[model samples]
Target: MHGKIPMASYDEAVASKLRRVSTDSLRFGIIALIAFLTLVDLFAAQAILPSLVVKFSVSRATMGFAVNASTFGMAIAGVAVALLGRNIDRRNGIWFSLVVLAIPTALLSITDSIAMFALLRVLQGLCMSAAFTLTIAYLAEHFSPGQAAGALAAYVTGNVASNFFGRILSAAVADGFGISINFLTFAALNIAGALLVWLTLKKTDRMMRIDADHPPVGGAWKAHFKNRELRGSFAIGFLILFVFIGTFTYVNFQLAAAPLALSPMALGLVYFVFLPSMLTTPLAGRVARRFGPANGIVLTLGIAIAGLLALLTPNLPIVLAGMALIAIGTFLAQAIATGHVSRVAARDKAAASGIYLASYYSGGLVGSFVLGQVYDRLGWTTCVVVLVAALIAATIIARPLTAPRV
Candidate 1:
């Protein structure tokens, strides 16, 4: 009897072709550009935080609010975009959002009032939220599952690289000109990103179209809440980010003062912690593929907790070491968790992503405020304590992952 070729061979052949198609597509380039812009916005704000505090004579608590404002705006916009569903042309929506995002970023260059700056930051957050959600959704729609993970990881690498370079650039510019100029530089970057997307991204009819049969548009939110795995993942995301933001937000202050006494340039170099993410993100996908995403999440969270404890040692080398550990662990966790959500919620990918991201950013917002207060009231040690508590909570949530749904 003649033997037949295995099904796996056909799948591998199809996957290889799709990968080639995806890599050559203009959509991938646009997505990567958007990802780069996201990081620029994030670091530009962070790099200038210390300067802003000194200029306005604002307390850490107030600064926390300003920093968290971006996330708050993002969370709101995510919900709104998800609820709107596939009715809108995602490409146009993303482009429009970028234009909106650039406005507030540029406005930072002109405004001297703290109140105005804070308001602008919030608008930037909203625009960012929409842009990110739409871009990811577009990618998921266009690429096959096997190709999507690599593409997503590439997008994330753009984010990590941007954080690294954006911080360095902002710090250098601030040292030469001023913090305001740093904001302008990022604004220009965003404008350039928008132009790139406009020129490159192909307009397609792939947008999600909601109709009468899909009458349960509003029900998607409620439906996502019903997902136990998704809820657990969101909780962990919120807690982890809360601590992550809180720690990074006040770290410059800590370094600038006391034993470290690092200048802005020196402190900016600490952002090298982001570099490992470029590697860990792809590795995370492999780990998730082999051992399952839930297991990868738990493992990463444990590593993060250990990293947080390492920072408690009070040695400069130990602190940097700890930061590196946290960065690796957090990135791994995010990569796995994001991929898990996409895989699990195959039908409502965009809505699921929006919800998960909302949780992720909302955690940043709440963490900034709560930890800022902890820092003010009890000091850095207390801030660490809050992060430890959040880590413990993540561990508890992660425990359920052990017997995860197949």
Candidate 2:
């Protein structure tokens, strides 16, 4: 009887362990889906930039600025969230922002005026940034210490997957149906994302309470700026996105024009370049752990620089190789830097996320305008030069972008 009882207890314990493993897997899957939906819209539009340029009858620079105006809104919203995030409900804010994001996404289907298009993009950005900022804070609050690293790695992997699939989805939908259909499809995705978060995420009141003892959020920001490692991370984030926007945005025009006039379907297929990055990004934590964060970033930057230089070639296969290399390198670097920020910001992680995201997206905003103008005037060759230089500069900054020393 005693032996039977012990076996029963052992079996019951095994069942419990299995149940826990299943729950954690399910949780990580949900996190990855949420991350994918949250960021899909950010770069998807670039896939169809040529069509928009023709439809709007605008210059490439003007169209680039208008399409990328969302980044400016993200930059602004990041700062706002950084300053006021301590008072927010992470889960509720995330779902609500995603719900609002759908509205502007739907409106894009009908907008004909370039100005209105840009405005909608800005509004979309604001909602996306709000949701994004809150989602990061949500994960931090909800996950355990053991789960946090895996959860974050899943999120970053989702981010990279979104880059690949979002552009493909955008291009295929726009080509198969129409541009209007593309925006509407994305609008549906935004709502679906809202539903996912609303349904799966539980309300956790883990926000830092602002009593008399806590310093003001503004003071926190001031201190963040003063931290050398944080500053270096911010710089690397800015430069990475700057180079990314320059390469992907203008490269679309290059492919859509003259010698290599890839169809929308083909352009979408080309974003398969992001596949390698998606595979590599989830390993970022492992890489950083093995080689150290700064060394990892420097190594990745070297890959990106090599890729940037390869884009100077007029050959289609070589250009695609460059894109793949760039995608892999930048994504690995971004993932490592993101993890570093989350670790190093010991005091105000939410506030740090906001400022870091702001700097990151601001680079996209600036790069869109600056590199678009460069592409419009100086051509793809000169634009590649600028991108390579930015990557080189990022390598320099990445040396100090590691976690803060204890």
Candidate 3:
């Protein structure tokens, strides 16, 4: 028959190409390791929050300060990395950052004073921010357009998986061995991640060649911020992360009180809700490609709002279901928004990624403190209301993404 090649043949060809590219390039490995390390850092802090509070005799407000300190450091480091682009070898920057990150992470195990622990976390945040930004930039630069979304999704999956594993592992270890041991184990994981990056991840010499041709425009940041689509995407990222991190940070505290009275391990089970994100992120990307990022974002935000509202009901199963919905929505929003930023950024994909990430972490920092205080004063109902408000703001901002890119 004189017919065109079968669609299945095209699919096989694409899959074969992807396998070859992934095997030949070290970028995928680097992205995976960075994602792993970032999770380690995130979970190390989160897993220990309840234990730290008990050990140090600190209030939720103070714990919020600790969380803010780390995120604030991440924001600062993100800005610095953006400015330092091309001036430094991206590989060297990431490696140096890994070393810097290791010092503080390792020290967290030995530190007795809350002050010292917080300081270490802040330093860890700085190092991790730089490492993460560079790694993400490298992946975007190295991968082809066809593969970029999947690569980013894989990286994000690493992050979501780490969130699930980190908390569960830390809580389990804390239950059996001790909290200190849990921190130490995460520190070891960080070190291992660093080594994996250093050894297996190829130096980005070839990738740098690709990025070097697209030199930075002097005021690229200004140009990027001017894009309505990017601004909207960024806002969505900021708001969604603010609510997501804030809720996760304090969920343990909420559950530990009257009605639920869940143990640390039981509370850690909430992270299981996040597992769906790993499965949903790639699907979200496909949906975004078909329906457009704006539509995906709107749908996801609506789901998130519903999830937040469902928390108002006092049923545990309902609350868990709500949390799952929130996870799916958050991941969908993140995948869509991040893809939007990468596509619409004027120049310097790394810098754009840095800006987006900086906004994201800044929201976490601000939200952690602000929402924690809100919860302290007004209770869980007020906190849910705040999250719903943030989601509404996200929906408003996301509307701009539907506008023709200027």
Candidate 4:
């Protein structure tokens, strides 16, 4: 009787927390916008890569640097923010990151040299990592554990929004006016997002402070590495992104080739296949809470593998279906994995989140650069094989994370 009463009370407490987080529409919208603005510029670079290749008269391998540069910068920034950024207020950090991001995004328009373009991408990447890492850390810190997953899902949906429109809009604009205009348009949006963040979050900024009275802790690096669950989560983080980026980075080129050539705008539309991620990610928490995070992750990975296999088929509709499945699986798995990271670390959660983000973007860099080389040398078939292998590896690593709480 005693055990039953406490258990019921605990459940009620968690339910109340979840309801509160779900109802905070204004705060959720601002954070989601920050995530959207953070990633759009990077995806815009992906969309314009083909144009840059022609404009600079470079090989696909060389043109890939444009994409890799930002990812590499994001990886670096994740680590830096994890280690060095503990003292800054997250609300100010998020808006400031966007404000800084707009500078390089605006500069992307006029840069003629490939080297300079890549350099600007690197700068934008650094700013992007701050918003990406801090927003989720903020969510994790503010929401109750039971509610954190739902909040993270909302933020991640914003990420999916950027992924879908960033490339398509940029490609459409680049196809019509020029790549320069594409960059300029997104830059304007970035500035507007920054203003929105400041305006919306101004009143509540003090309430959301991550580490209020505690002195910033040290040894975060060693402590995070020592935690077994965290180690597994980081590995899962890396492999999932490695597979996701590897597939998408090269698909555009494949679609532009002889068999089923697509226009720039059409190529952008193809990314609509990824639109399902926006929906799947937000609902992922319900799935995780029902089944368990580890089980949910493995199930999503299996779905992703099936999608990759379907891509091996040459039929356009089949390929589109395959892309949709991959999107659903990838986002589902990522949402679970990311929310797990936020909940697992009790102290210096921001730094722990940073390590996970660092690994995640590091995987992206490898996927875009390393697998891109494989595509250049061997063929898309070999690239697909590599991505499948990586997903399987992630599933294996996630085996230890079966409990829903961890």
Please report how far candidate 1 places residue 257 from its true position, in Å. 0.7
- TM-score of candidate 1 on Cα atoms, chains taken together: 0.89
lDDT of 3 by residue, 289-338 (tens): 77777777989889888888888876788888888888889878887888
User: Per-residue lDDT of 1-406 in model 1, one digit per residue for the tens?
Assistant: 2334666778789999898787655555556667887647864556556777887788977886785678888888887787674766767877778877878988888887778877887898888888877777777777788767656766887777777788778878887788777778877888777776677666768776433454375576567678787788788778877877887787767777778877777777777777876677668867876777667777887888788888777588888888888888887887777767766663566667778888988998898888888877898887887898887788778666533356
Local accuracy of candidate 4 as per-residue lDDT tens digits, 311-344: 8877888888888899899988988898788778
Compared with the true structure, what per-residue lDDT tens digits does model 2 show for residues 1-406? 5899899999999999999999988998899999999988989999999999999999999998898899999999988876777778888899999999999999999999999999999999999888887787677667787888788778887888888999999999999999999999999999999999999999877784433365877887788899888888898899999999878988999898878889988999999999988788888878888888889999988888889888877789998998999998998888888878878886776678777888999999899999999999999889988888898888888776655566
What's the distance in Å from true for residue 136, model 2? 1.0
Per-candidate TM-scores read 0.89, 0.94, 0.87, 0.87
Clashes of 2: 0
Candidate lDDT scores, in order, read 0.76, 0.88, 0.75, 0.80
Best by TM-score: 2
Displacement of residue 54 (Cα, Å) in model 3 is 1.3
Number of clashing pairs per prediction, in order: 1, 0, 0, 0
The Cα RMSD in angstroms, rounded to one decimal, for candidate 1 relative to the true structure is: 4.7
- Candidate closest to the true structure, highest lDDT: 2
C-alpha lDDT of residue 388 in model 2: 87
